[model samples]
Target chain A: MPMNAQKSVLGTLGSRAWITTVWAVTIFFVINLLALIATVMTSSFGTRWLGTWLPAGWTVNWYASAWEEFQLGDLLTTTFEVVFAVVFLAGLIGIPAAYALARREFTGKRIVMLLFLLPLLVPPVTYGIPLATVLYKTGLGGTMSGVILANLVPALPFVILVMVPFVEQIDPRVEDAARVFGANTFRLFVHVLLPLLLPGALAALLLVLVRTIAMFELTFLTAGPDSQTLVVALYYAVFAAGVRAIQSIDAMAVVYMLTTLVWLLVALRFVNPTQMVTRAKRP
Target chain B: MSDTARNHHLPLKMRLSAAGFDGVTLLVLPAILLLVGFFVYPFFYGLWLSFHPKDGSVFGNYKTFFSDPFLYETISKTLWLSIPVTILNMATAVPIALRVRLMKNQRLLTTILVLPITLGTVLVAEGMLNYLGPQGWFNRTLITFGLISAPLKLVHNYTGVFLSLVITGFPFTFLLVLSYLTGIDPTLEKAAATLGAGPISRFRHILLPLLVPGLAVTFCLGFVQAFSVFPSAVLLGAPSGPTRVITIAAYEAAFEQYDYSLASAIAMIMGVVLLAIIGAVLAARSLFYRGPAGGGKG
Candidate 1:
């Protein structure tokens, strides 16, 4: 009896130690991450930063220079154009497909699901090479449309995957009720389904928007000099960092970070982050 | 009864609806068509392109890839970087997620963790270049505290790429694990405790078994993300040397060398390698218990 009691006390100490270790690691990670981000933020506005805990002087001139030198205004415009186009099209195409997958069972359903899952499962760079080849083959390569189309390969599927669960949560009997009330198929969709699906559709599209903005491999491969998005432009600035001011590049990095972060913040307000990956568990 | 009788007289849409190809079902076609055009077609086109290399006959690109040490070595190098990083991220995520699940401010913690993900690889790489640089705050703090005499070279090397992967990949792995952990009923753990199973035993006997399937998935997805590490590999690592991953090879082939066929071959190889890894993980997962891990609504 004494031994068993001693074992229990030891077990509690072990568990406590384990919990502390986990928290320590997590806090360490979080601190490092915050410091990393803070470094970039500070350097962006700093006049000189070399082997110091803090910069010699601070100024916002780098932001102005980065904006002008990188042509960020045009890049932001192009990015928004591509992102909005992809989001709008993905919603238009994906929501209806999600509704079908959720409400009805049919032949070849598994195959369809696999098709949607492939783009998400397969890394974009693996497929982006071939995709860029095909796009460049046709006249679409290096065009804004090409960027939008390449992005939609993943965005459409993502919307469908995220929305399918949302659609499934609505009872099928509700659709039947709408049908029995002398509603046509179009009317049933426009009036009855749209209202219920709006929140899900919004969540899905917002996510797609955030994803499109951040999607690098596809945009980097497919975009030309003229069609470069902000992320792609930022990549170029970093890649060819010898000529540009480091502070300016950091400023551009800050801009790119804020763009995606704002959308992600808004996205989190609508959808739980976990929902993004939950559909992966489905058979 | 009247509806059935009148169904035949209805339009082709109605007739198709009777066979389960309803208007709603047809809605899926546009998305399917898009995928077929962009994804399916490009994949096959790439395969076909791989067969017709620039210099030699069919299988030329594959032959070149295998024969050239520089080209072939990327597979191992990539696997070396990605596999370990994926494992580390998953391993770390499981414990942290388990703790976070029991926390009161789960959402806030999760949101903070997720910031790195939205920051994207390019920005993270850029940030790492500054923050982890010899002159950055990380080294400065260590030096100020007298932790080390000389500044560490954290960026522009393998350590740089590895650190960037953890920063970006950990949140994703954490989010997935947290979701899966939340799905398992807390009562099961309670039951285990009541049965005198210690916390470690409870986790090992109950949670680990339940989490294998989700872990397999998390690993694959995380592996895919880390495997195709491009921007960071280039911006943060010795891209031509240590971190010359398959994607980098493909990029160089297509863009730098302007060899589309070779690039296509490399891309195909990359895809195959990724699929093989994921397949193996899933297969191993089947060796574990595969049953409902949740209670209540699930």
Candidate 2:
């Protein structure tokens, strides 16, 4: 019961506990990495062990087949179109509105912002059915425009949220100074505010792009055969049909994962994620 | 004299036009209009539909939903699973966020977590099938480790569904919490420790209070999100047992049975329940994080 003896016992147990937790977390992450590696390797490696451990042989046949048979070029292009349209147009619309909200005193700003995010908070299963009804009524269902508009549920809110911080950061004095000099508000936005906000805008673009491409539930409910995205394709290819139907998904999963990873990398180039998320309060 | 002539020469209408009538009505009008037409209108339509059936002759779908014992079970079932899942998600995610925040290159780890968010419910459902199916690696490992005599029945059941929801949902909850946690200045914790406070004391007295607001928001976000899940219910949840969520049934009634009225009723019930919960959570958030800005980042 001496202090030193008690301290030594506690130290031993503490170190052991720390080691166990660290190893467990390390193993947890390693499992994720292995899943990624196994995905790539299994494309060519074939089945090995209990079909549990790894692939047996190796070939580029799957990738070549996916490209040729899946019509990936068209899928990629279509997805890119919808994704860019949602991200860009939403920004085109959302940035100025968000700036207006942040800068000028407005009536019902909270309610308006809430309206923008309603699509996100509402259960998609419920609204999706009704929206589909509206789309069908308007002859917009199962079309590119439908997908673009449907995807707006996530993208508009994101752009608005991103811009709030950007607008907050830029000093109002700059715009006011332009106004005093007889420079109109339009000139102030174009000349003073717009250039300074490119980074936040780029960040918003990338985030929106990511959301638009990966958008599943709405797209599935709304997409035409023509508008099927990579995520949707990958879903069918894996669960609904495997190699015989569309070949192994390993290649496409690789492609899909890589495409997102690349975009995230590029987005980080312009905007810091931490900063974007936290920038609202720092001012 | 020249300035006076310039002012006199300018058309008053053009100068007035420069004043800008309404940025709100102009700039945000697209999204605002879309929300009204699509979002707000649907709720009313849903409310109306819930009150009346979509048959050639109108009837009350809401009465049927509330009256029928069989259909009403889904409401209770969703509550049971959603509450547990929200608590479970926060339990798993908060620690993950804490640990992840303490590290460098967090965005990279975040992107990895977030890739699944992009994958959507369909891909996550498929991935769950791969990992949790009858011939899945989880059961396969169990057999290999001698933890079981044979591969266990993990899929087509609640275990499979719950696990899938966690994996799919963790990234989102983690991102929200991580963003919240990063905003707290770490120096406060250091200051707490310097005063001879133990780790538990520091977290309890200093950390948890500051975290309450963030924790409250994340909790509500997780709750609403978990409660309304669909694809997982369709793909992995217990088909007949307790895990069949209200949304899946609503989808069936709406799309498969073509019973829009019933679907609308179910959707309304789900929305009302969710809004109530969100309102409650936000109230708690406002109570605690009432700084000068309220600093309620949401």
Candidate 3:
């Protein structure tokens, strides 16, 4: 129906040809992505996928071996531990800052917002070196806390950026009404504002979780052997000086992708992923 | 000072009530402290470290980086790679984004396109190593269909890294353009159509002019992203060849050679180039900026 309208409106074969070309290219791109993913997923489970239409055999051994060799069970626990800590702290600190920035105008607010944006704007590796230097100098480096702190450089700002819009959506009169009803600041936050902010906070933290989980450069720079997240571990499993099975590495890749995909799916439920692209550009 | 002052204080408390600088500061201070302690301090520390080389000579690392051909060449090499990649990404993403916008399954399509992004660059590089490697499916299928007798050298080269960068970067560029495209008023196209303008004219006269600014912003952001090619450059590229971007140089300088000052200098160079490009783009964007109506949802 839309095409019919466009056809009449356009009334040109060249225009019709351009639309067809667009759809064709888009489909081709999508097919390539699916094929790439399918190839990796198949190799992870294939016993021998040696240059053929199908693998000669299949087994679950690669997954089991990857688990043992990469010690992914431990790495996964470390990932979750680091993710939860970063997410919780980001929400703890970022929500109030968002509330402040959203509700009240203050001197140097643009500068303050820019300061929050620096971490997200600059590449992590640019700052990771010196940040790790200080963390090491202060004796916090090579620990889970160090990794969490490094990730928080971006996560806190992200939470604040995400929450500002949510906070702005709420009317100020509700808070004024609560104040008039004899509520204190703390009580007003808990009783009146918390419920309204919950969904946004959840979405922000979930994005933070996904970001930190897939965050390679910061975690790689900061994490100790015991503190390594899954992506960092996967990086080592592939690049570190060792002879490892390709299938097992592929398995590890699948695991990391799934972990990130799960959170992304959850975050997508609450927030439009496309909005994140534009948000990063603006702030 | 008794009754009148007490009443004045009560009124002040009731009126302002956690809505002033004190309240904003109380809420914002923790985040500020964290940024200062982590982001600001480290950036300056890196700047400081860049000056004080291990040899105890000021500007020593900068001198070394400039003197060495391998290190110095990365400046041009990075530009060569990032510029084409950025241009190609925008070129392809524009039409694809426009098409995807009109689709009914827009969300699902975007979700699939964005899947690789969430997988992170490292995993994507790893996947490319396998899928694009010799004797991988790409080669096997070609040989099976008698397309080629010899397997192509796809991975462990410049081509491999370029492919990986495109895979990860294109989705982001596509999404950014799609959002900008959606924000354009459809009525303008309808108005042009009612005036008997063809689709080609409508696109050229109506859409193209409006999209130029958004496209410029997209190119700058996309260029910065592609310029910071780290994981893929290390994983997929021929490390010492045409793909020896500056980030690898910095990483090696810091970690391998354990030369902190040299690494910081290289990073500073990278940042300067990025900022210069972004500044230039923004400066150029303003020449074409059409105010509130042209730019969508700033």
Candidate 4:
């Protein structure tokens, strides 16, 4: 028994060593990545940072420069317009369909599900070109309408996918009870089902809003001068074949980061990232 | 109308209200129409566009794609970049995820890790341009620490884009592996221990078999995401040499050169490569595990 206990103690010590080593490495890696991001964030505010541990001085002028140079006021307003339209329209159409999918059985259900999966599975650029082509051919290209329409491709499907699980979790008997009280289909959706599904819908739509805002490829392909979202504009700011101050560009990047970070934090508050991952993989 | 007719109408209305095929179709049709119009139609159109050039030959665009050495180079280039990035991500993520899975601060760590993903790739690329530039802090810090005499040329090259991919790809890969690891029943490892399997043997015999499929899947997802590199390559990479990936080629062909058919052909090639990798991974998954993997039961 003494010998066995000694072996177990050695084994535990070995395991502890391995764990500590790996934990140290993880912390190192995470800090390095975060430090890189932090450098960018801090440098954006620095008036002129040189070879040093920290910037010699800090200023808000870069943010002002980025705002003026990037035409951020117009860009942000356009972004909000597109994001709101996408969220509202996707929710308007997707929630009822999710309720139908959850409650009603239908033929070709698997095929419908596959149709939804393709957009999420395939990379957006693979299809963005043709989608952009079609929009241009139809003369909807280079317009806000075109951007919103292109974004809807992914947002609508995503809403349906996310909402289906939420709808499935609801007790159908409550909905049926409303139906039994002589509520119409639309009324049941509005009065009873809507309240129950609000949390899920809110979570799903917030995510959709975030996705649409960050959806670069589709938006990049379809956006015109007037319709560029914050992300695409950031890309152009860097790659538009002109000289610009690095700090100014970094400021723009920070704005983009903060915009996405705000929405993601809100979405995370409602549905944690792990829950989002599991929910995404549910189908 | 008599009382009996009115009563019959109530049953018919109730049946419709319960949402049969017609009602369900009405509810679902708008979504179906939107997807078909925007998603499905565009894909077929892109495929069809690849086959029809102005010269009116179905094989012309593909022939041009294959014949041009500059355009053809991108295919191999994309594969080279993505494979290494994917492998590096998996290699780095496995150890970290394994550690994080057991840590009490997992949620906080994960949130910090996932912050980059929300920033979007373009912003990350822009940040990289500042953070990894010749005079950037990365080099400055290294120089300050007496680690190197000269600043490394990080951005506007393959090394720069590779670093960006790692920064963005690692979190996704880690998250996926961590999720899959949780699905593995801890009792399995404990059971192996009871049979006198040490940590190494227990991991090799039990955990490794379960982890392989998940790793392969992580690789596939990571590869695909990395494979579709455009904005990063343009922003942080040379875009004409070592880092001019296939998507960049396709984008230039379509948008820059106005050769839509050639662009479509390149896109098709890109799609084919991605699918082949995914299929290969999934096939290997079946070979490793005979039973259902996780299947949400573990």
Off by over 4 Å in 4: A1-17, A275-283, B1-20, B211-213, B290-298
Chain B only: TM-score of model 1: 0.94
Give all candidate RMSDs, comma-separated. Answer: 3.0, 5.7, 4.7, 4.6
Best by TM-score: 1
TM-score of chain B of 2: 0.84
- Model 3 spans with C-alpha error above 4 angstroms: A1-11, A280-283, B1-20, B294-298
Fraction of native Cα contacts reproduced by each candidate: 0.82, 0.30, 0.61, 0.58
Candidate 2 per-residue C-alpha lDDT over A169-227 given as tens digits, one digit per residue, 9 for 90 to 100: 78888877888999886787788887988777877778777666766667777787898
lDDT tens digits by residue: candidate 4, A215-274: 899999999999999889888888973688878888888888888889988988887665
Question: What is model 3's interface RMSD?
Answer: 1.7
Q: Which ranges in model 2 have alpha carbons more than 4 Å from their true place?
A: A1-26, A33-37, A40-52, A67-69, A180-187, A237-239, A242-250, A271-283, B1-25, B55-59, B67-70, B104-108, B134-136, B238-242, B280-298
Clashing pairs in 1: none
Best by DockQ: 1
Considering only N, C-alpha and C atoms within 3 Å, which residue pairs clash in candidate 2?
A44-A58, A45-A56, A45-A57, A243-A247, B53-B59
- Poorest 10 consecutive residues by lDDT, candidate 1 chain A: A274-283
Considering TM-score, where higher is better, how would the candidates rank from best to worst?
Answer: 1, 3, 4, 2
Candidate that beats the other on DockQ, 2 or 3, i.e. the better one: 3
lDDT of 1 by residue, B150-189 (tens): 9999988899999999999999999999998888889999
Which tens-of-lDDT digit does each residue in B1-298 have in candidate 3? Answer: 8865665667565545533565565699899999999999988888999999988999898899899999999989889888999988998998888777777778888888878878889988887887777867777778889999998998878888888878988998999999888888887788889999875688788887788788987898788778888888878887889889988998888778877778878888888998999888888877763754343355
- Chain B TM-score, model 3, reads 0.89
